[model samples]
Target: MGWLVGVVAVVALLGFYLTFTAKRVDRLHARAASAGRALDAQLVRRAATSAVLAEEHGEPDLYAAARGALDARVEDREAAENDLTRLLRKQELDSSEASDVAVIAASRRVALARQVHTDFVRDALAVRSRPLVRALRMTRRHGAPAYFDIDDPTLPSVTQVTSRATRD
Candidate 1:
């Protein structure tokens, strides 16, 4: 009887542990999804802002580039975003101080959003990859979590842009 009781207790504890792990994985997946949506919104904002800035600056080439990328499909979005960032970094800002400041702020937001998204993705992946989680198939419904791979640009900080504007 004592041996039977010990066996039941062990089984109960294992069940509880598995349940806890499953719940944790679910929460992480939810967090990743929410972060992804926020990141997408920020990317759209960055692209739209860049397009407007390009048009306002009277750079037809830059405007066309930005517009093309802004309208690209999801499969090509990473490349388009990278292209847009590369162009923005290379092009000289011929606008007023206020305009330059606005662009810098938008770019900074994109950088921050990307960082947040990446962090959430990493968390989800870490949880999903745990030995117990995998053995018990905690992520079976969701399959495997994938990271958003992108060559995120290092845009100028607000201070750098402001100082350059002042110097110029």
Candidate 2:
């Protein structure tokens, strides 16, 4: 009987230990998934700035080119996330380690995307503030055509006509 009692106690202790460990594993897994989603959200938000904000600056060509590049980088980041998730699952990595790797990968892309967008914005702003823009605006306000050769395609048809008259 004593031997049986001892066996029962050991079994109960083992059950409790297993339950505790399983709960801990579950918590960690939840944290990893949540962290992955958070990182993805940050990446998405940063990716949008170049498209939405830059378009307002009257830079269609620059906006189109940058938007394309940003879209590609964002897709690459998403694929990286998917690959990391697959790696973690296949390797049966610890939940904490899986979350850490995902966070790091997302962060690297976020930093790069933000840096590129920031540089583009800075250049656009610098160009907006140049003397040429101000001078041209002043000329238009004074009812004088901007001081440019008529062959520039951006010039209006009426302005181009004036240029044609001068040449003829």
Candidate 3:
């Protein structure tokens, strides 16, 4: 009877240990997943801001460096997301530094993208319109001669032997 009771007590302790440890593991996994989701949302917002700057500038070269940086940030975000899932499965810290590096890279991208857009908007030729766009060949040709042919006989050629320079 004594031996049987000892065996039963050991089985009950093992059951409690498995139950508590599994719950702890699940809670840690959940925390990691939430952190990863937050990081993804932040990176997505940064990428969108970069896209807006690119569109506003019209010239990709104006923001190519910044855009490339943003792309690297996005790649990092995606890698972080993937690593979160992997960590959940493998329960390891081998890739946590990589995720940290990704966040740093994204922060740098945001700063650079902001600076490039600011400079571009300030120096942008398209942004300035000191003179309105005038149609060259349109009916309202301001600088062109009123007549169709400059040498038309009916209109009298100005460039004939009767040079305008001589007459003037």
Clashes of each: 0, 0, 0
Ranking of predictions according to lDDT: 1, 2, 3
The RMSD of every model to the true structure, in order and in angstroms, is: 3.8, 29.1, 33.5
Candidate with best lDDT: 1
Q: Better model by TM-score, 2 or 3?
A: 2
| lDDT (CA) per prediction | 0.77, 0.41, 0.38
lDDT of 3: 0.38
Using all chains and alpha carbons, the TM-scores for the candidates as numbered come to 0.81, 0.37, 0.34
Query: Which regions of candidate 3 are displaced past 4 Å?
Result: 52-168
State the lDDT of candidate 2 residue by residue for 1-168, as single tens digits: 999999999999988866664454444434444444554455554334433433444546434533444455633554433332333222221223433334334445555544444444444334435575455442232221111111111101111124666888
TM-score of 1: 0.81
Off by over 4 Å in 2: 57-75, 78-168
Candidate 2: the clashing residue pairs are: none
lDDT of 1 by residue, 41-157 (tens): 877777777778777778776677677777889888888878888888876654445666666677777788778888888999999878988888889877555566766655664
Give residue 54's lDDT in candidate 2 (0 to 100).
Answer: 38
Lowest summed lDDT across 10 adjacent residues in model 2 is found at: 147-156
Cα deviation of 121, candidate 1, in Å: 1.4
Rank the models by TM-score, top first: 1, 2, 3
